[model samples]
Target: MSDSTSDFLAADAHAQRRYAPLTRVIFRLLLAGLSGFLLCVPWLSASLYWVGWFAWVPLLFALRDTRPWAALLLGWVAGTLCSAGGSYWLAEFMVNLKQVRPLLSTLLALLFWCYLGLVIGLGCLLYRWWVRRLGGWDLLAFPVAMVSVMALYPMLFKTHFADGQVDFLPALQAIDLTGAPGLDAVMMLFSVLIYRLLTPRRSPAAAYSRLAQGTAWALLALWLGYGYINLYEWDRRMQQWDTRRVGLVQPNDAITLGIPEPATGFTRESPPEMLATERLVAAGAQWVAWPEARYKGYFDDYSVRDSYARAITRHGVPLIFHDVERRWVDAQRISFNTVALLDEQGELAAQYRKMLRMPFGEYLPEPWSWPLLKGLTDLVFGEFLRPLGAGSEHIAFDLNGMRVVPKVCYEAAFPGFVAEAIHTDGAGKMLLFLSQDNWFGETSQPFHHGNMSILRGVENRVPMAHLINNGPSLVTAPNGRRLASSEAFNRAELLADVPFSEQAGGSFYSRHPQLFLNLIYGLAGMLILLAGWRGRSRVRRRGRRCSRKTRPTGN
Candidate 1:
């Protein structure tokens, strides 16, 4: 009886020991998912953005003993979860705003999530490959590889939610050097540090080395110092110029095409748009702005044109509005999505058309040219989408003696586009982002848009005014501060004193963006190739040694 009891106890102990590794793996996977969710969305609270700094630490530890293929799979799970969690609003928007079916919208969301998730999975695969090849020096290689992979990853799967990934402004000051991709590098570095602190190393070789810690710390210090200096320089520059009072006229009106509501879509501009602009100018606005695509057919419609002239003539202020112009040259019809600025004399001073159009939203891609895709879109949207041509030139409006760069809607998300515009006037530039965020409803997408768009001002040392429909017109200063923001989904106006810096240099980013990214790409590529070659050479030498040892001593 005693022997049987002992046997049973021994078997139970063995089983527990066998299942321990699996249990650890499960726990680590959960950690990775949680960490990924927190890092990319800051779903808990905006203030808890610090969680992103080391969110990938658990995943790094989890991948310690994983094969390259296994790492890819694990990464897919984590990345998919991360993408889905971050963009949960996309599904809601499709259903509520775009009127897509719930199931179909969810499936669309899933497809996009998986596509973006591949970047993370491939990064994991590459990480495993390097860890195998570099062995002890992997800590040194990690950040470099991570930065390159992340920088390239988003090009394949572009989404501008990078703000939630790293919210450290001192670190973000380095954006002029590496753009937002630099934040991903810092996040990877932090993950490595966290892993070193928490994970125990059983061998001297397995010990986490402080190889990149100096580079990381040096970078942080440099960024902070640069940020301080940049702000100081901007302040010095600001003192040289007079402030302009820019007014944002947000008419909180629901858009219903073919259905005339109080202040919606080119309805003689009476209920809100004209009223708001008039009030703002009366209150001492030098330039008043409106949101995107507010009027469907501006130039062709006499009433809309008359309304625009009436407002400018009465207010005696430059009024900016979302407009379109149709040109029929050589029997080819073309439409321009434009922001038209009317001078105080009630005449069109300048117009900036949208160059970068959204795929499917503004224009459909080649896939949608396929019959299947066309059919799908037709079914969902009730018709094939109108294809909008790209604008060739970057046009700026001269408002109240200041060069105002206009970014229509999602164009603000493109940093280079905005940078080019900031550099257009040579110096002393202000910015306006005419956006209609109504389609997103009350989702976190507006927050994402705000986070992504505000960074442009920081990069170029320019002040930005966002005149968004469905509310939340605001300004972001050069110091990365958001001010004078109106409430979302409300008919409100933001009149703020906006200042422009007379600094001649657009920014370091403008002068040499290609250099920074090229260096990163070249370094990352060489390291990978060199490590892989060394690994192969070591294998060859080991094989030769094994053959020699097995020669039987020539007996």
Candidate 2:
């Protein structure tokens, strides 16, 4: 061949190689963005249930070849987009409110996105290391690893509720006893399996043939399993309590944080407390439940006491209203994450304070603690540091001969807290969930938050009487069927004839909390350790060879 011909071909090859780097970078960025979009899609108000699983595919691709810095940048952008889009409902409500400066509220939303990005980015890095050592058959690791990161990611945030699973009913049902962390793990594992099925194989024809066969079998197995399990557990639990008529009060008032609380969704001068109570009584509710912080301000004191007394005289049924904590001199500044219980006469019966606090959104536990200098924390994290002291003990109230265990706001998402509360009350207890779903607005937050109760209902084998400040006030039977629920994003109430059942004697979680968490941590730790050890050994071996080569000084 001529020299000119060889030179021309070599130049062309070099040029092609140069574009490879840029092409790879562009591909990673696009994949990252797409993954972000898919994650947010499942959170839309009208999203189909199956759409949530689409997120795992692009995420798995991101895990495979994404660069470290790209992992951060891409994850940050995606996290922000997903979080903002999914929970944009919060901003819609906040935009019209006068209490918080609009600019600050918007800033808070961005802050949430950035915070979640950091956690996910960390997960990506961890996965990169873990996957390098996984066995050939470890296809399941893709989903399991991603989900584990998602589940535990909330713990790093100031609020555990941030980890709450949204809209994944089957996943949440698994959480009733498995808890949020476990459910997250299971979802991620399944996601990897589904992604694998959808991915095209090296040979398209072979891949299609295998996938077709596997898919049919998988569908058949899932159908029979779901049906059999549902049927088997159906009649196992029998309701023991006498039926009670419960009225849920939904006042459509948009609450302005710093102002005097209003009763209806719109502005009204008189307190809606007494009026709402009278309406519920007139409606013939054996029991009435008000959403979280319905009255607001100074609830545990004398003025509030007199107010309830007057309301009770007019209403014959028992009342459950959320009380705002009175901030007084050194009163520990313990604001009530409270659910107030009152008898037919308005006499104070019992109360349950919220157990789980939203991270960064709720309180900043240790702001000064830093792992590495570059690891950034959220600014809004410490802003609302209203860490109400944890509720000291569990309390139950008896109403119309029924024992009721109460949970306030985010407490329903924490399986451990619910199980403990149920155990305190023993069998045949009705679980009453009082929540301010308004904080989450019309996003998946409220729906996901509300659905969590269904799992608790099934796990404890007790009926749930749920009252939300906004929408999705739901009633779930002991078997986890939704008996009644509010139309989304509206102020409404439901009267449900709940059939109570004895608390199930054994729960998978109750018998094994430490075992599960430890096993997960242990596995994660081992993977991390193995990766670190391999990296260190390589460094040491290289160092030894270099040392031997430079040993001329010993001669």
Candidate 3:
């Protein structure tokens, strides 16, 4: 061959080699992204389930061959997509509220995505790091490290996956003995194991085949075991107080009542709510639940309370009204959402102010950010607000022979909070959830909220009655079985006979929460540090040996 031609060919070969690695990296990233998007579908479902968590296995496997930073970036992308897709409900709420510009809302959406993706990527990175140190140990340690961090990271950020719905009950139950942190560890570890098994570099065909077969069997066993256990629990614990007719008055009132955008504002003077309650009571509702913030006007007044009392006193039926407490701040007063329980005589029985106030839309932690926050709050026309102080106590009231516990609004998401309410009141019977979901009418908010109640029901082994102002009013059996649900955006009442039982067999998690999940991760974290130290020592010893071997002392 001519010299020029030979040189051309050689240059071409070098160029191809240089770009090949980048091409492969891109391919792997694309694969990971596709896998992540698909997996996120379930997590972002109307119910916000984690059914697709299994897809992480394929993505993690694809990431293993890449550089550490590349793995992190890819994981981040996947995580972002997942979070954005899963939590698009909040983004949609922002859009409806018209608070922030669409561009800013999109940016915020992506920011949440990135944050969650970072957790996913960090999990992959931790798995890789542990794999590098202990080699084969990545099968267990890597998953443990990644899941532990991912699970805890959400808690630290105050947006834990525990609050999400769809299969969380099963997921939590699967990890009940281990706790969520440990369950996270187990999930990640299993993914890594699958990844390692699938990768040709890590395993031979026969071993891969064997491992795959074993995995299928193990998974099948788990499914059957879970199905049986769920059934067993249902039969044993799913009893409720017999035939106590509940009158759930779903007054589909505008959520932005006092805020803005011309809601059909109602006060105690609004006869419709009173009429509806009377209708529900006449239809055999012994206890009537009004929607969240059911009052026509600001309800922090005695006269309003007296009027409400008189109305219900005439019916001789207990009424639960979700009211708001608004105090003027600057030109506008901030409003707090609250649920007030009343006796048949209309006397205030118990009240709970909402906790877990919405972020960005609610009060900013810093006073300086009020203007920025107000700009955002203007979407819903709500006054940028301050959080109501946590309720001093949980209300456990005895109606007839049943002891019932009530949770207000989003308080159902926090298991500890709900448990505290149930146990502290010394009244562990049935569960009552009073919420106002009129803000995001017919959106995924109500469904997502309903899913949280499912988890609460299963976790506490208590039958729950979910009463909402607008949307998805339903009752769940102790085993997380849905009995009946009211439609969204309907002005109506529902009647369900909830049976109450005194049997209190605490689940595994109820007995020892932090110990099963948190402590194990703490120990695993310590172990990773220990493994890293050992790895460093080994590297140093090898370096010293190499240096001596190549020394010029003999020459």
Candidate 4:
């Protein structure tokens, strides 16, 4: 239109052209590969979580200057690699622990990684579309699309039973309102902003790009500020807790559930679990928790019955044990990972059947129930393919002063499940998480599982006590502080206080879960629709313009 406007447009075109070299197929592949590896490193260790902040920056940079299709495929390569790297532990679990045949395990691993990669790839496609199609709103649109990618990650990426974006504490502090999806949004925003900040600009609106950079910094500042404020409040709230002394007994006796024999080099003769319980009571524990499948037989067996009864009556304290119960479900027999509470008077108080089963570890699919498959599972793989059917109802136990919610292993990762269990019975209860961590052995699986439990505790504002076979058994306060813990595979009894918050307030996340996420998902959907409409309108406009230009003069 105007000369100044023409110059501005030309400058924009030049700037856009500057990124043209990055569009080469070779460069796209390399950039994507590099990005995937970078993203994977931070998650490999518990200590390297800091790496996540900028891990996707490189990928973002590469994607920003490319065609939508090229960017999508490039992102797929990175996403696939990232998923595989984070979950490489699965291959180990299959071969070394479950001893699933190599070919099958590899195939399963591939399928899982690819599925996760597909989610990420699709996310990249959306990001490219939004940033390219949205004119004035590119800055805002990019982060929103990025958030959609990350928000879906927690729900979709289950191959490793992961929540990488959730584990970032600064972002996690705001999880009460945002839940997992919101935290993910914050992370994607940070990544997009960081890339934009680092990216050089030649556009006439470079000042606006710089402003976006400033906004990104401001957002980061706000996130950290709010996070620290929440942390301070978390501590202040915990200070007013009416604490109850609790004990976690780590027996170090581990068995592959449903396996006929136990792993070698384990404490063969039960590792004095009764002794550990006594130590817990002596250490001033009003109640003690035990690991899953803690004893050889149920309380019906005289030995287990006498020991548990004596522990309750002798110490005048309740003892909790989690064991597997077999039952018929739909005329098919399956085991239930169940927890039973023994009161001070040596009477059975209540029981909780595990409701949330780990996808692969616990809840194997029905297809594996075929006779041939079952035979292979027994002969080739000594471990159970499927140990249990999920429990139908939530159960809680009262320990004189307060009620305690019980969740078996793997359920700790599901924040909503724990929140519901606590909310159903009203607030002011501690969560007892029982586990046999032996299958994970000394890997990051145990650590990853434990870290996620912190999110659960904080979200519901509930204290949690974890007792594990082959532990690092721990007690986490409502604010996610570790009150007590023992080293893994150690014979020890942990004593800690269940920091029951005196504050009568519950978390917003508990009262209304997934509310923010649903809105975010809706917004993402709208943006996608808008992007599509805009794309079609541009195509139609270009066609009309070409028709006018190509019309023969007086023809």
Candidate 5:
């Protein structure tokens, strides 16, 4: 055979081998699993956070030269695997706390994983579509698509590429300017650059590629540089600010049927939490915080009020604690998950009700609350589903003239919610995040929950004390540094000299929280339009060429 014929035969055989069913499936699964593992490890432990910088490289590689539908499938597989691995605590939480059967708990966890996976699948689909229309501009197309999906997609628990970078303090500082979504975009850009560097054959011209890489590195340096500067500035400001001894009490209470036993009753003259509070006060704690749900009964109850009053009056130190608030609204008994403050005299200074209630945990959503499904929901959820009233206002507690804003449980996870709370309360001086994480047990859940407080503090330039009932309570400075922390599942008390600046909440992000996110949305829109225009122009050019070729030799 001739050389060209032999070469063609060889190429045909290679294509056949590459497209074989078993080979393709194995390769795809390997790539997806690898990407998922890389993404999950960082979420499991902060020490592994550096792994997230290139976590998506394998997924990008798998999607290369693949059809949109195939790319979507690969991305979904990777994303589902990542979420399932990282959030394996969910199954345990469901089975132990929510009273779900083992099989049903597993299935629910799977559904949750798949739901989050759709965001990644959609992002991959968009990326492939853009590549087909506008060539391999992964640098721009990939980040924009991923960031847009993460920003727009709604989930019970929101996840972002930046979540894995929570421990990377220097990188986290930029969040004050751009929010988590911006950090996500930056991380995506880094992943794309790494992918391009690894697969030079698939990248742009060598000079252009080098320039892009250089620019990315330069920007990264500037980003970290800004972080260092802010870190120093915040630290300096903290030194000059008024300092007060703050204490966090972790009860480490036992949970039964998803509710903490300590939360329900305080029959003892001095419960463990109260004793801890007394000890902290003796240790010179000017202000103390107790985790959410520690006092479950109605705060209006005379007994409960008396108990809180006795504790606060005895110590003569301001205290913040959580309880259930009852109100008679239109002859209906409505309850609220509330965090309240008591002055030195044990008077109720202020109370902030939890605004963002956990979907199934605290309140049932639309379909579940619908009349038709009420029976099934009630049967399945049982007493675990106690719908609480939502709060309309963000109340701040005054501690020695400093305003302290309070967030209950997962409310701190939301950037806008925390920012609004601070802004609404005249730029609150400190943030007190009250949480009960016992339902999830000693899993990575507590760590993940605590990590969120880091960004919230940094974004608003305020000190934060995240007090959890099941430990891993922490104190964070405005620079995202953890001043003190306790291990999960351990009953512990933490005391840190938390500083509060007279000038609080002037961070650019605090004033204009949505500015960066809106810019990202605009950029994504612009890219989509550009891709469509390019595709249309290509089709028109091809149409003209075909018309010229089909015209008979009229000349």
Candidate 6:
């Protein structure tokens, strides 16, 4: 070969070496993106639940042998993409309901998506650090790190890796024992097992991978067996429990913008909600409920309050409805998102003030509340962001000798919060969730919200009547079974036979709310300490070898 030809070949090899890292990075990013897309599939539609089982496989491959920071970046990429896909309706909700500009709404949505991504990124960072410190025990390190981040990191919207199993009733039965985080652990453990099994034979983890794989399979089998048994037992108990006829009203009303003013009296002779209530009563509903903001006027107005009472009096049944309560505090008018109950005599029986305030909707938090950004916030949100006062106590009402716990809009999203409320309220026999989901229109937001609320009932083992405006309202049994439902953007009245068991206390999860999470925290802390100690011992061994090699020796 000529010298010129040899030079050309050398240049070609140099170019490949120079661009190899870039090519590899691009490929890894694509894999992460694919994983993100898969992660969102089950959330988009329940029928695609199978996709969630293997969704994280590509992301695991991408993190293999990667540096700590690089692993975080890849995890963030996957998480952000997944959040963006799953919650694409957020931008539209902001623009249409909050009256925000399209560009600003898109930017805000992107910021939230990135914020949620931090949880996954931090998990990956921990996993990489643990792997480096404790050798190649991917099975233990991956699940612990991921579960810890998921359970510890706080996000505006709480989503679990196990949410994909929402439609899988048998798998969901375990949540009653350990809450959703346990399912998250199960999902992660199984994913890591699959990752190890598929690893190449020459890889370091391949030798003991079979042992780990066998153990994982055995655990999974036991878990599924427990799920089946619990599901059957819950079904049997529900069948034997007494049933109460409840009416759920879905008004399908358009979300009115701006803060509403106190009305002098009922404006219309017969509002659609009142008419729906009357129909439900005629259909043999013993109790009735209206969705949040269904009564647009302030209940503090005596005329408006009387009008609701008179309607309930005519129906001859107890009624629960959502309204805004205004009171004078410090000589200033304050508003509360409240759920009011009217007895059979058309008199006020009990009321529950909403405890959990939605971050941007009911109140502003942190940087948004800064005085300097007040003008900008006002321009984007206008009067939509009402700084409502939060309630301090968990309140429950009586209906036909049974305790009914009420939860307002955003309050239903939190697992621990809901469990605590039920536990504190004397282990309520029934749950009533009132919400206005019209802001999200006909998007998947309403469906996702309703599904999550249904899970709360299962966790606590109580019947639930989830009433929503512009829903997908649901009446769920204690076992997470849907007894009745209403379509979105439709005027409908559902008469459901809600079943309730006469148990002395709530489910184990509701009774011991923090036990599972605390256990996870302790386990994660121990593993981190163990990793640090092992890392120090390795360093000491290396130092000893170096010192022995350099020591002077006599012949």
Q: Which is the leading candidate under TM-score?
A: 6
| Residue-wise C-alpha lDDT for candidate 2, range 1-555, written one tens digit per residue | 999999999999999898998887677767777877766665453235455555656766755545445555666666566666656665554443323566877876577567776666666666665555432223434434454566577643222221333333344444444555654454455556666666667664334345544654574356336534653465454444455677887665565444444544632223564566667667667887777744554364466677667767665678777766645537556665776787878787777766666544454456433444214443322234344655577777787567777887767766666777766345657788877766554566677666667666655656786777777778876656676777767756567776654444334554443445566667777776776787788789999999999888743
- Which model, 1 or 4, shows the larger TM-score? 1
Compared with the true structure, the alpha-carbon lDDT of candidate 3 equals: 0.63
The candidates, ranked best first by lDDT, are 5, 6, 1, 4, 3, 2
Q: Which scores greater on lDDT, model 3 or model 5?
A: 5
- Alpha-carbon shift of residue 13 in model 4 (angstroms): 25
Model 4 ranges with Cα > 4 A deviation: 1-24, 102-107, 136-143, 146-170, 205-219, 257-271, 293-295, 299-303, 328-334, 360-363, 366-386, 424-426, 502-505
- What's each prediction's TM-score? 0.91, 0.76, 0.82, 0.84, 0.92, 0.94
> What is candidate 3's lDDT per residue for 1-555, written digit by digit as tens?
999999999999999999998887787878778767765565446353444445666576567656567777777777777666656665655555545566776776676667777887786677666656654455455556665666567531323444343344455454334333444454444555556556665355224345644664476458437745874566565443355777777767665523432234545554466778888788888887776643555365576667777788888988766666675656865666666667767777766666666544444455535786556545533444344433456666566656667777777666656655554223246778877776554766687677677666666566788887787799876666667788877766788876555544235555555555566577577768877897999999999999999988853
Better of 2 and 6 by TM-score: 6
In candidate 1, position 18 carries an lDDT of 100
lDDT of 4 by residue, 1-555 (tens): 999999999999998798776556667678777878777765566566666667777787667656778777877888889878876766656675577787877887787787777666777777777767765355566556655665566442232212554345555677666555555566667777767668677677643555766777787788778777887787887776677898877767655434444234433233366667778788899888878844445533566566567656877989788766777778998887788888898787788888877644575555565776766646645655566678888887888757788888778766666667766345667777887767655666666666667667767767777777777777877666678878876778788877764344357887777677677778888887988899899999999999999988973
lDDT of 5: 0.81
lDDT of 6 by residue, 1-555 (tens): 999999999999999999999999999899888888998888888767778878888999999889889999999999999999989999998987688888989998999898888788889899998888877777777877988898778777777756667678777777877887787787777778787768776755536656767878898888888888888887887777778899988877766675543333436434667778888899999988888964456364666667877888887999888888888888988889888888998788899999989887778878988999877878767765557988999887888767889999878878889898777444437888998888876888887787678778877877877888887888887777889998887878899997764563378898887888888788789889988999899999999999999999999
lDDT of each: 0.70, 0.60, 0.63, 0.70, 0.81, 0.81
lDDT of 4 at 321: 82
lDDT of 3 at 19: 100
| Worst 10 contiguous positions by lDDT, candidate 5 | 200-209
Clashing pairs in 4: 471-488
Off by over 4 Å in 3: 1-12, 46-53, 96-98, 154-190, 193-197, 201-227, 236-243, 257-267, 301-303, 326-336, 366-387, 423-427, 552-555
lDDT for each residue of candidate 5 in 388-454, tens digit (9 for 90 to 100): 8999998878887778889898887798778877763445478889888888867898888888787
List ranges where model 5 is wrong by over 4 Å.
Answer: 1-22, 202-213, 258-269, 294-300, 424-428
